[model samples]
Target: MEIIPSNGEIFLGKEQSFICKSSVEATMKWLSGDDDEEIEDELGRYKKELIDETTLTLQVTASKVEPDRIIKCQAETESGETTNTEIKIRIIQKPTFVKDVSVTKVFNADSDAKLPCAVEGIPTPQVTWFRNDMPVPLLPGHLSATRDGTLTISKIQLSDAGMYYCQAYIRERNEIEHKNVTVTVNAAPMVTFEEPFPKITSKSNASFTCSVTGHPKPEIVWKKGEEVVSDDGQKYILSSNGLQLSITDLAKDDEGNYTCYASNSLGQQSTTLTLEVIDAPRGVGAGVVAGIILLIILGTLLAVDLTCYRTRRRGFLMFLSTSILGRPAPRVKLEDDLKKGTSDKSHVVNISGIDA
Candidate 1:
């Protein structure tokens, strides 16, 4: 075949073989017409190289051929040529790399984000972070990259929340593998009073509670009417159970709204609990009550006796008309009685002998 060039490109003919560097010296002898044997005749007239031949088989990537990588032969033909002639190979840049990565789940908004990075040509690709399109600052505290190519956001607040991206770079290929992540910080919990406020006297024990809810457990702080009630230094007690706030031992001045502040790492929430204080009533002793009962009984008896006396003075009595010992009668002398009965009257002259 003659030399031919089309569109600034030279094409290798079927008859001419570009042997590899390993068999360069031996193949040069044949190209320079030093051999006139079976090898020469087999390559020219027979054209047996293209009959049952496959492309080259490389262990590494097609475009990543390096100095020490081995090129495998499919037929294992030990022709002693030390290289292949029919095999054709070329070197080119790697294809476009990792396009994107994502984190589907996160425990909390302020927590870190998980991102996966994948490249087209190779592993161990260099990773970089960006916001919108500009490169982000990689520092100790503000931003950090993980071993698995994930990004951990520390103290991610609402301001630091938004779309973020990661890029995988392979310098030789001019390839870029990119990923996008969305960050949302979970809001803090809120606390509130759900029922009637506690009412009590200085002499009585009083208790009240408030409920709180949010992503992270919120801390509660209570306050009296105008003064703040804290655990720092006071007689007022405040206790919380993540969801509840209880205050005990109410005082006289503990009236009005008792404010409660629920705070978390994300934000703060507040609520007011109206309180009413009452003064305890004074009680009477047992002895005083017993004397008052006695007086009441005596007054009832006097009224009953006066009513009975008035009824008896109405002259409601029965008079008997028979000759009884209670009748009024005149008395006769013993001499008049003796004159009526004369026979015995003369014999009774003596006082001892007189009979009536």
Candidate 2:
């Protein structure tokens, strides 16, 4: 007996077949290893078929194939002699992922971090790493990979924050699988000012803002000397996020050294600003004083005019009273004129004499 396709390899879950033939009619049997008992034929997995009176075929699935397993086809004639041929079966399987990589990882600056990916299958898969769709090298310093397919990073910085991927490649099956993870690096607060030292006019509105950068969103605070600034009343207005200080109707007292403090869980930072308030010009002040003095002089002149008019009117009244009643003329004989019933055109009489 002769077997067709003496050796074969197939992937798991696939079907493989071998044919055996003899010139004369004979009973066909299939055996595995050196077992005396014949191998039983199953319906789908393992099957035995007769092609004519002399040819036999054995069909087996990759799931039934074992390591170093050999199948023998034997033909026994009525004379009690046997002829046999053997076929070797090899099983191959595709790569499969056992553990998926982490979806996301977070680390502070100057810290260490790791990403993991694991896989299992026949013809062991090889693992590779990538960052932001670019291949990552297995280097000695900064970034490296461990034997178990773990990507390690030392002293992580802000620039290292990005998307990372792990890939598993199987050469025999020509298959590749991938897992992705996102890494974030947190940093401390950094404070800066647009205008480091600002010069503003007195009695005008002024606003100072401190720009901040950090992760976890730093909290902002404004300080002057030992006192912390807040929105206590209308004089000072603090921004909602506390990054700005607004002064309405600014005065000379508002001018000073101001400090902005930005802090978070990681660390804190500060920036100082010197505010110079320039007073109004001397010429403008002098004009204002001259205007006030002119108003006072005009008011004094109005008062004096009113007083003089009142004094003149009082003197005129006194003179008219004295002319009418204070002067006494000689007494005329009013009584004699009345007795004579004579008409006297002009006669003067004293009031005391004419009482009767």
Candidate 3:
């Protein structure tokens, strides 16, 4: 006896048929596995047919068949000799996922995360990970996958949060299965500034603005030195959703290191900046007073020259000399003294004889 197409394989829940042909007329029967248990047609579990005196057909359901089972064809010839041919059945079970598996995972920044795909099959399937429809690269210390369909990512960041796809592939069977997983990563507060430290003048208000970013909206706190700053309406004020802290009526005491602290459920962060309070300017300086006095003196000298030109018809210097010396000597007397006085030139136009 010989079994046609000796190798037998079938997918789960499907039916497979086998034909056994004998060289001579004989009584044919089917037996299962090593025990040689006779296969019967009872309850329709298996179907058996005889098309001719030498050919026998047997049908079996894969779901009812055991792994690596052998179906043997036995032919008893009229000469009382038995001939046997057998085929081994290989059953293939498609990969299927277990029930009640979690598809979403949440983690904080800088933390480790894992996603598990619970699947089972006759032949183990290969598990791979993909992020945003692209394959996830497996790094030694960063991202990795396990044979049991679990993906792990180390030191996760905000950028790592997204949709992840887990696929179970059986290459030989040309079968594929996938599941979507959502990874959520939350971060702590991060503080930034446009102007790190500011210089403010005394007697003017000082404003320190803080820029912060985080998940779940972090809480903000302002501190001066070791003391917490609060809104007192007149002295301290907080606005712009508590991102800005303003100190009214600034003074020298306000100059120091001020801290802006931000915190969330994930973590906390802070930044410190110095507040420089310079003294406000005082009244007019000495240089300004000196310039004013110099301008006044120049105006007085110009006024005296104008007055002398209009009233005495003489220059300011000449008028000043006449006022210091007494009435001037007459021009005619001065000329006569030069022509007549030869004995005493000092007697020329004596001040005592000059006309008043």
Q: Of the candidates shown, which would achieve the greatest TM-score relative to the real structure?
A: 2
Q: Which lDDT tens digits does candidate 2 get at residues 173-255?
A: 68888888899889999899999889998888988999998877898888987689888769888988998898888788888
Where does candidate 1 clash, by residue pair? 98-177
- lDDT, candidate 3, at 37: 87
Worst 10 residues of 2 by lDDT: 329-338
Better of 2 and 3 by TM-score: 2
TM-score: model 1 vs. ground truth: 0.34
TM-score for every candidate vs. truth? 0.34, 0.53, 0.52
For candidate 2, report its TM-score: 0.53
For residues 1-356, what per-residue lDDT tens digits would candidate 3 score against the true structure? 78877768777788878899999999999998679988887543578998888999988777553667788999998899998888988887787787434467888888888788888666887877888788899999988888777888899887788898887788888889888888888899999867877998899987778998877689999998999999888999999588999899999888998899999998899999988989888999999999999798557545655654555434643544344334453222222234464664322222243454
lDDT of 1 by residue, 1-356 (tens): 11111111111121223222231223221221122222322322222122223222112123233222112222223455333222223333342344445653334646654545544433245777787788777668757777556666666654566677777776754667676776555668667676656666765655567776665567776666566676542345455363333444556665688777788887898888787878777799899999998787556545533443454422211111111113233221212124674554321111122223
Alpha carbon lDDT of residue 163, candidate 2? 90
Name the lDDT of candidate 1.
0.48
Model 3 stretches with alpha carbons more than 4 Å out: 1-7, 17-26, 33-37, 41-57, 74-85, 100-102, 194-213, 217-356
C-alpha lDDT of residue 152 in model 2: 89
